[model samples]
Target: MRGRKELEKYWGRPYTDTRDWSIYNERLVRRGEFYLSLDFIDHWTDLVSRMNTGKPGRPFHYPEPFITWMAFIHVFLQMPYRQMEGFTRKLSIFIPSLVSADYTTLFRRIKRLDISLRVDPTILSRNVIIAVDSTGIKVTNRGEWMREKWRVRRGWIKVHAMIDIETNQILGLEVTDESVQDDARCIPLLDQVQQHCGREHTIRRLLADGAYDRNEIFNTLEKRGILSGIKTRTDAATRSTGSPYRAECVRERVRLGGYREWAQDIDYGMRWKAEGVFSSGKRIFGETVRATSKEGMIREVKMKMNCYNMLLTMVK
Candidate 1:
């Protein structure tokens, strides 16, 4: 009862609109420019010449930049390859220099196109606080209708990502099968962030939820000198022989009174920025992938995430 009373003492902050309406409004308008930017047309010849140089295949008909542009559109608009083909064909009528690649070409190229995660170098140049989390994206949209009518289950793929808590930008992303566990990906995600930051020491702290409360996680972060803000499980034993780091954290939480107090001190609420990313990503790109093949599904998810990062960069 005393604990309940203590928790009740905390109240939500009053709502405030801190955004610059004029600047924010302009940023949203630029989102449309991503859909139909024609700047690639001007550099079409130069880009194609560069891509074809030292290549032993039939002279490439499309520039790599053009293919990249189409790939971005394919994921952002959630359109099928055929629709993308038609989209290009429609554009080619006015701009004769733009020859439309068929749906087959669009499929093959986008599958192999490298979509790298982008992070602000400024974030990497300083001590960083990172939040890690996983969210599932449906393998196919047909799962719902099939489940309702035929009782079929189409599982989802998990996206494990690490984001800079200060900037809320995704620094690393990995896609795995539905069977993969969240705790298993923690180190790999950290490794990616470490690679981006150029050194492991640049990561000052890591934030995550209870799914990452294992002793191995704490020990690993301790070795890297990264403070762990991972929440401890309610039933976790306060003493552990294997990982003194986790044991000490559990004891500290008790000393501080409870999870709420400990979380407040550590600013563990910042972990939810990862959830916000998932929510905004789903709302923008979608919750379901359109690809039928495993490789295609992975590439599609990466493209969606890359597009998300690009849009965020544009506003800045």
Candidate 2:
């Protein structure tokens, strides 16, 4: 209610004109009754109606801008919903750009919004190379362990990610418990890549460690016309036969003149991108311990993924 003049100043300035500020302003008003006159609020509500939802029902109580703003605060501050709600209220007094909403309302709206996933095709398609890896997040109660060990105790939830070689954008992400094997996680992510690309015969290559060296994984890739650049593991019998899975073999197979040389090269350089995505998720959105029960954990993982997707969309 106090920041109307500042908001007006921001509205009057011209910039890249990428965002539809009129719509953004309307949403801001719904979050709190701004101190502005009725004319401004009316202009915003009219713009909101024209955004084209033909469903006959009450309009969204929390407008789009408010939702977007709440999401931004949630991620930027890395705070829980209640903390975020309190911060928004305090911020609204001096920051005209800020809008405040109740904590319960913010939580409900976040759970309901079905944010779309948007990945750039150019990044995914360039060179047809992908680096696959997985990292862990905590999901269970480990407060006892933390107290005993004098450190943070946590259950692990693994996020398997595939990153583009050229652009370093996350191409795909799949969440599972820490107990799930890496190879099992990779299978669905491969399917996701195919599904998202909308191609039946995209010839992309995957690079990964020996954890993905199973014959089934390789065979699956071969069937899909994708070249597997995963490092090979030596069986005991094969080792006894004097045929070892040597570094040269790996280098040669992934060498410039070899079957998966380019794939290996791309993978080696960009494998850390997947880890970086995990770190960013945890650091920015407090994605550490989500829910206690298995079902709750699954739902929390989806929410975190949604949050990650939204942040990526906003930044890019």
Best by TM-score: 1
Q: Put down candidate 1 lDDT per residue, 197-305, tens digits, no spaces.
A: 8844388889999889888989999998898899997767888868999998888989998898898889888898899999989999989987888877887888889
- Segments in model 2 whose C-alpha atoms lie over 4 Å from true places: 1-58, 90-99, 140-154, 199-203, 236-269, 283-287, 290-316
For candidate 1, which ten residues in a row score worst on lDDT? 7-16
Task: Supply every candidate's count of residue pairs whose N, Cα or C atoms clash at under 3 angstroms.
Answer: 0, 1
lDDT by residue (1-316, candidate 2, tens digit) is 5376774464443334465888667654543332121233334455466643684766554466566556545544446888877876886787554446789988777766554344656434534667788877766545665658876645577877776555455667777777788888788887776666665336477777778876667667766767666766533122223323334344455446443454335455355566676676777556565456775566566556655554444433
**By how many angstroms RMSD does model 2 differ from the true structure?**
13.6
What local lDDT does model 1 show for residue 56? 100
Which pairs clash inside model 2?
A: 254-261
